[model samples]
Structure formats: C-alpha cells, structure tokens
Target: MNLPKPSLRVVFLLAVLVPLIGAFLWLALTSGPLAPVPVTLTTVEMRPVTPTLFGVGTVEARYTYRIGPTYAGRVRRVEVQVGDRVEAGQLLGEMDPVDLDDRVAAADAALRRAESGVVAAHAQVGDAQARRDFAGAQVARYEQLLLSRTASEDTAEAKRQEAQVAEAGLALAVANLESAEQDLVRVRAEREALVQQRANLRLIAPVDALVVSRDAEPGSTVVAGQSVVEVIDPSHLWIDVRFDQLGAGALRADLGARIALRSLPLDTLPGEVLRIEPRSDAVTEEFRAKIAFSTLPEPLPEPLPRLGELAEVTVALEPLEPAPALPNAALHRRDGQLGVWVLDDGGPRFAAVETGARDLEGWVQIRDGLASGDRVILHSRVPLRPGRRVEIVERIPGLPR
Candidate 1:
C-alpha cells in the first residue's frame, strides 16, 4: 500500500527547477517589459484661471530721428558721440560750407549794389522832374508873351514841345527806379535763402533725445538725406513683440504686461500693451504687438536696455470663470484623438476630450468628456494605451519637482 521512495537524482532536480521557475516569474512581473508604467496623476478641479500670453520681443523706440544735411556735403565736425543726451535745437555736428559763405557774401554785395542803383535812379528822377518843371514854366511864360503880342507863335510851340519831352523823361526815370527796387528785393531774397542754407549746414537735434548712433564722422562725405547721427526719445521706448496667433484672441491694448530683459533676467519690469499691430506675421503664424513700460525702473538699470535687445514678455488676459480643468500634461494624442488617460476602478482607459483655452500655469479647460473629481494620468514614463497597467506616482523622474 506504500509508494516507492524517490531517487536522489530526481530530488535534486526538483529543488533546482522549482526555485528557477519562481525567479523567472518574479522578474517578468516586476522589472521586465510586462511591468506597469509609472506615471503621475492629478484630479480635475473647478477653478478660475488667469490666462496669459507669452511672447519674445525686442526693445524699440517709438520716435527715431536721423540727423543729416538736406544737401550732399562732407562732414566738417561732429560735436556729439553715441550715447550723448541732446536737447531740442542742440547742435550735433556741422557740414562743410564749401561755397555757402561766399555765395551769401555775393548776394549781400548784389543787394547793396541794387540799393545804390535805386538811389542813383531816384537822383535821375529828381533831375528829370526839375527839368520838366523848368520846361513847363518856360512854356507858360511864352504863351503869355504870345497872348500879349510880345512872343512869336513858333516860339510858343517849341516851348510846349520841350515840356512834352521833359514829361516823357520823367516817366522813364520813374520806371528805372521801380526796376532798381525790384532788383534790390530779388537780391535780398537770394541773400535770405543763402543764410538759411548756411544755417542748415549746422546739424541740430530736432527733439530732446538720446543719440544711439553716429553714422558719419568728421571728414566723411555723405549724400543728401544720409544720416550723420541717429537718435531716439528715451522716454518713449517700447518693445516689439510677437505672440502665437492661437493664444492671441484675447490680446488687446492697455492689458498689463511683465517684461524680462535678456540682460536682466532676474528682474521683471512692469509694462502694458501699448497696441496690437494690425498686420500679422503670416509666415510665422504670430501676432505683432507693442508693449510699453508702465513705469521705467528708477535710476534706470546699469547698462540700459539696448535697442534690438531680446526680451521675454507676458501679457495678462481676462480671467476665466470657474470651470472644470486639469493639467495640460494630462492630455495626450492617441489614434488621432485628443484625450487623457483616465484612471478608474476598472483600470486606466483612454477618454477622448474636447479642450478649450489654456493658461500660463499649464492648466487646460475641459469643455467636454471630463468632469471635476475625475483622476487622470498627468505624466507617464512611456506611451499609454487603453487597458495599460500603470502605477500612480507622486512625482515622475526627469521632471520638475
């Protein structure tokens, strides 16, 4: 009725194989390819989100002036250098007055000569008038003599003819005087124009400004309209920003902004949306905007923000009412569907979701297919699928704590 005792070889094989098989199963279930994926989780919450638009920008000036001569000339001297502060009408530099001084002197001389000619014409006119008066008196006297039978008719007729000639001479003299006066006026105008040209040669600042550039130096020849100095109104500085078109729907003027200059990354300056540019960048799919400092830093930052320097800008948009939302990291794309991996009593499942606006803090609005109190996978160590096994973690590796 008793069974036969097993051999030693059989016993040895049974002990070795049993432990080997158990070790294999433990490895497969724990750290092998069949193991559960580790992920962080979060619950959907109902709360208000203050959305913000972030954009990269550059420092710019609202008013820029290029100081140069109206006519082509060589630079004679430059009184101001780059970074100099200038006031309205401040002389910045001067252009070579090649022949302008000489031209002005010549015009003055012409004007004086015209005046002299006018004076001479007036003297001639006076002499003609005296001659005319003498002729008239002689004609009147001769007519009286003729009436008294003391003068002949021929003599009376000659005196009358002489009076007519004198009258013509007086008229000619008056016309010459008028011509001289007109010449004098023309010369004066020429002189005034020359003086203006001479004044223009001295480059003057058109406004109280800070000189940002010196384009031409002394002895440098430049063409008309070429810049010798470039300046900008320091108080009217702004940033030219570009934001993603997708998040710019709520962008508007007067919205509050925070600007971080590349040079001063640790400090953020207060600013506001000056304006939204009508033109958008089609190629980059971005909206252009102007952001101005609400109040400049007191005493200004050492080494002021240079024009064209890069900056990071954040514009505060209208706050959203309380709504069901979850961390944007929870959203995922699978099988051409936007969704989140929802964890439930059954298991992890893929739930397609409709999303709305997102905020700067990484929260996204859940318009549909999700509700408050629902738990979802925020970040997973690997790609997720329906019915995938997962392990909830407090924090995922390689992510911010």
Candidate 2:
C-alpha cells in the first residue's frame, strides 16, 4: 500500500513536536516546576496570649439614700419629678403646713405675751424694792423713836409689825417676778422649735443629685421621713465588678479597663479601677472591683452607665508568653492536618500547623510553622498548593466588611 510518505503538513507537525518534547524533558531534568515568587500578605495575630481574667459588675450611685422627713406629715406639693437634677438646699417638696403654721403662730403669740409679762415683772420688781426700802426705813425710825421715847412704845411696836408685813409682801413680789421671767424664757424656746417645724414642712434636697424615682406625687399624702423621690448623683456613678478571688490579685486599683455596657453595645467607655474591695461581698461572695469612668464619652446621647445595669469589664494585660500567631484566614484543614499558607521566596507554600489558643481578638496562636511578625494571607479564594504562585495587593482603604 502506497501511503503518502511524509507530506509537507506532516513534516511541519513533526518538526514542532520534536523540540517541544525535548524542552519538556530538559525542564523535567532541571527542575520539576518553576519556583513561584513569594507573595506579600498582611496578617494580624496575638502571640501566646497569656491567660487573662475579666470581671462583670453593675453601675451604681456612690451615694444612694432614701430621704424623708424627720417628722411625719402629709405632703401638700411636690416640686420635683423623676430625672430632675437637684442641688443642695434646693426645695424638693412641701408638706401640709396648716397645723405647723398654726403652731408657729401660737408659739409666737405666747412669746409676745411672755415678753409683756417680763415688762410687768420688771415693774413689780421695782415696786417691791421701793416697798422694801420704805419698810426698812420705817423699822429704823420706829427703833429710834422707841429709844428716844419720843414715840409711844405701843406705836413703835405697831410700826415695827407693819414694816415686817411690808417686807414679806416685797419678797413675795420678787419671787413672782423671777417665776414670770423663767416662763418668758420657756415661751421663747418654744417659739424657736415652732420655727424649725415650719422650715421642716418645706422639704429640701440634702445633697446634689439627680432625681431617679418619685414615690410622692403632687397632692400625695407623704409623711415626713417618707421617700418623696429617689435621687442619684451621676457624677458619683461607680461600677462594682465582682470577680473570683483567683482573679483578684491581678486587679489593682487604677488599672486601665474597657467596659462594655449593655445599653450601648456599640461603644466602650474607658475607665480606671477605683479600688478593689479587700473583703468579698457577703451576698455575692465575690471580690468586688470598683471602677469609675474617666469622663462620660462624648456623642453619647444618654448616660451610658445606668444604675443597676449589668456590665462587663475586661482587664487588659501584656502577654506573659508569646507564641507565633497569624490571622485565622490563613489557616485551612487538609487530610486531618491543620495547615497554613505561608508565603516564602517561592510564593504561597502549604505547611502543617499546630494551633494552641484562640482569642476573641481574631488572633490564633500557632505552635508551629509560623513566627511572630511573619506575614500571611488574610483571606484567599483558591486552594493553596505547596508551590503555587500568588500576587499580593495592599488593602484598599474605606472598604465595607
């Protein structure tokens, strides 16, 4: 059979394959595959995160008191409502003053009458002194007349008896005057007490605080010493974070803390540890850590720390031990092996990894195949081969998650 030997088309095809096969053989002998240039990737991780402890507590007013009156009386008018800021000596509410006002007036009138009595007593004293002098002089005159016999003995004796009677009357008048003076003093004291009662009827705030709760409404019959309103000083707000005794030693006063409030989840307020209670709370049986905000965060629409609200406090610490860490995105599982994509001089390389701990900070500590400050890919779409080529681009700014 005559096969068309080696046509021009067949020759051209053979010619192309001959060199291509040789080149392929040459590449296999030299290197199996060309090395991939290392990719530059940025990653974030925490070195061996030493164990840290945190505490959760409630915010409260440093000075919380239930104010009431010393004496019980019906409330007539309430001057404040819940959430009102009050200053020291600011009037809060008024009690019914009908009875108190009447008592004050009566006491004042009695005081006035007593003063009049004092004047009358002074007059009586003067009169008594004059009578006493006259009586004494009459006795002297009687004695002299008796001795001279210028006056009859019976007449002198009668004058002596009359002078004795006048002296007794004068002493009685002086005693009456002293008694009236004392009565005046007592009446004046009662008037002072009445004045105090009148003042008490007008209830006033005992300290600077914000009113929290108002138990007494307008026209509500609130007795003295009853709670008209509950007030708290926002400036004096503090947090009590209870921690176990195990975590107490690390927590010192004035330590920097980050607090997450339940009300405002988006924001965190910076605070300092005010103090740590040496003794654990009796009810909670946990060590209490007190913290106060440096300043209320600006742009906050309302008070971030509400009284009696649950809050979480995290005590930040420097790592005692450091382990190689990388961003979680660089890790993958293959054939029951946890592997990470590490960029080397030959681009992205797959290496087995041993992970130790993971923190909420998105950092995973690696026990193997990574070092601190090593750059790794954050996120990659394609599967990583041992010697795959890759290109890295710096992260763009202002990108949405």
Candidate 3:
C-alpha cells in the first residue's frame, strides 16, 4: 500500500517550526537568561580554623660570635677561610707575638736570677751557721780555761763577741733568703702573666660554627675588639620574622610556623615561634618574632642557607571555634560588609556574612549567615550580582559535600 503524500503547507511548517525550536533551545543552553554561568563553586562547612599571619622574614643566627683580638696586634696567620666549618677550640688565626715573646723570655730570666739569689742566700746562711758553731765552741773553751785560770778574760769576751756576730749574720742571711723567695714568687707570677698574654695571640673558635666572614687577613693590623673572623653556630639558626603589629596579636612563643626559604621555594621548613621581641619596629609598625626549626634538615643541604636569607613565613595562631568556612575568594565586599554569593533555588543571592578568623590556607570562617552544605561561588567567569541566575560549571575539589 502506498503512503499518503504530505502537503506543501505541512512541509513548510515543519521546516520553519523545527528550526525555531532548535534555535530557541540552543540559545537557552548557550546565551539566553536560562543559560548557566560558568562558575567555580564550593560548599561551606564547619572545620577547625587556625588563624595565621604571613610575613617576610630572614634567616639569622640566634647568637653570632664575633671573634676578635684581645689587644692591638698584627695578624700573623689565619688557619681557616671563609665558609669553613670549624669545631670548638679550633685555631682560627694568630697575631704576631712581636714583643710578647720577648716579655715572656725576660720574665723567665728574672725568675732564674731570683732562684740563684735564693740559693746564694741559703749558702750564706749555712756558712754563717758553721761560723757560729765554731765561735760558740771557742767561747765555751775560753770560758772553761778562764774558770781554771788558764784563759784570759779578754779572750773569752772576744770569742763571745764573734759568736754574736755570727748569729746576726745568720739572721741577715735568713732575711735575704726570704726576700729572694718573695722575688722568685713575683717573677714567676710575671712569667705566668706573660705566657697568658702570648697565648692570647692565638685566636681559637669558641664553639662549633661556620666561619661566615674573615674580616682581618694575615699580616693585617687589628685593634682590640675588632672582629677577625665572624662565626655562627649553624645548628642554632633561626628566622627573624616581622609581622604587622595589627595581625600579630595572637603571636607568641611556641606557635607553629611554615617557612619557605627563598632559595628553596618548593620545600617548606617546619618551625616554631621561639620568642616575640619585646620591642616592635616603630618605623614599620611590625613586631619581630624569632622562629626556630622544629627539626633540622638532615644531612644539611650543601651551600646551607646562610645568615640573613630572605624567607616567607606563615605562623599558625590559636584555633578558633568550629564554624562554616568558605574559601576567601568566595567572599566579596558589598556596601563595606563582607558577603558571599550563595547559590539558592532562586539563583545566586548576596548573603551577608559576619566573618571571623581566617586561616593561612585561604579559608574564612563564616560566623553568621551561612551553614554547612551551603554552596558558595568560589570564582566566576562573568560578573555576579544579587538575584542573578547561575549554575556551577565545576565544584572545586576538597570542599564539603
């Protein structure tokens, strides 16, 4: 059986009507009011929010040791060069013991002379003692002779006088020996002082450290307190961070920090707040904070981060109460109040939010006007406004379901 032919009017109507319907559908899906605006969306939810402060900082040694000479002298030799790793008591440099050596030698000679004088004084005392004994025997014999009327009285008196003279000589010798001993003591002390002064000419490292700089080279003249070599303990390194005073209220000792060394941008060093400086920078209106590494880098990377290296630091403050928080990009300023564009059945609505603490990861706490499971626009390809129709093109990963 042959099918009935369609009329020209039906054909025209079909062609025209179908095209219009197609066009309308295409417009609706692509560019019409019904079309969904491409946007990045996220759901706000309750999460532990840790307030953070971001600041530029510098890596510094907590204690810098400036090794210098104790007195003015010409540097004789330097054992270590700049950037050399040295241990405690390692010889660093030495000053010319120009006159110090001579002084020590003179003190030594003086000590020997004092010792000889003591020996001579002792010998004199011995000689006087023997003489006194002989004189005493003579006096005794003369007295016996006189008792027997065999010795003259004048001879006995002369012998007694001689004994007394010997006794006095012995006392004088003892006094001379004591004086010599004191002179020896004084000379020995002088020698010790000279030796100490000579030892001071040798510069030694006070602790295990990295030699950062060599201020005075060999043969260079340096005055007292003038740095010859600057050393710093590598293990005792810390970062000196300066945060804006306004945002540093919660900063204190022991707070955790994330540090990005300028040289190693990809690696984040874990750190803890060591101290908050009592004084703040008046010019910058910032507070200085000292942060130390939580764990030292193992096998410390070569060309170790030097002192005064620039770094970026983010300090984690106290955790705030759990609240529905959204990405910071989701929030916008509307009439001086912070609000986020919320996706509702009606469309994108301007939801005024009272925000609380914000975290380093860009999450802002929505203290009011938002709840868990509420979708907020993270980013938009087109400008957004209140009551505008929009559909999320993609939901950013890691957002609440």
TM-score of 3: 0.80
Q: List the residue pairs that clash in candidate 3.
A: none
Residue 392 CA displacement from its true place in model 3, Å? 5.9
Q: Give the per-residue lDDT digits (tens) of candidate 2, residues 132-177.
A: 7887798889889889989898888887787788778778878888
Clashes per candidate (backbone, < 3 Å): 0, 7, 0
- TM-score (all chains, Cα) for each model: 0.74, 0.63, 0.80
Q: Mark the 10 consecutive residues where model 1 has the least summed lDDT.
A: 296-305
Write the candidate numbers in order of decreasing TM-score: 3, 1, 2
Candidate achieving higher TM-score, 1 or 2: 1
* Winner of 2 and 3 under lDDT: 3
Q: After superposing candidate 2, which stretches have Cα over 4 Å from the reference?
A: 1-53, 250-258, 265-270, 278-285, 295-304, 315-401
In candidate 3 the C-alpha lDDT for residue 346 amounts to 54
Residue-level lDDT of model 3, residues 1-401, one tens digit each, is: 99989999999999999999999999987888667676787889889899999889889987799988788989999898988999999999999999788888889899999999999999998998998899899988999999999888998999999999999988998899899999999999989988988888888999988999999888899999999999998888889889999868989899899989999999898999999999999999999989898888666667877788899999988998888888888889888887988777758878898988888788888888988988878887667877677766655345432
Query: lDDT scores for all predictions?
Result: 0.91, 0.74, 0.87
Higher-lDDT candidate among 1 and 3? 1
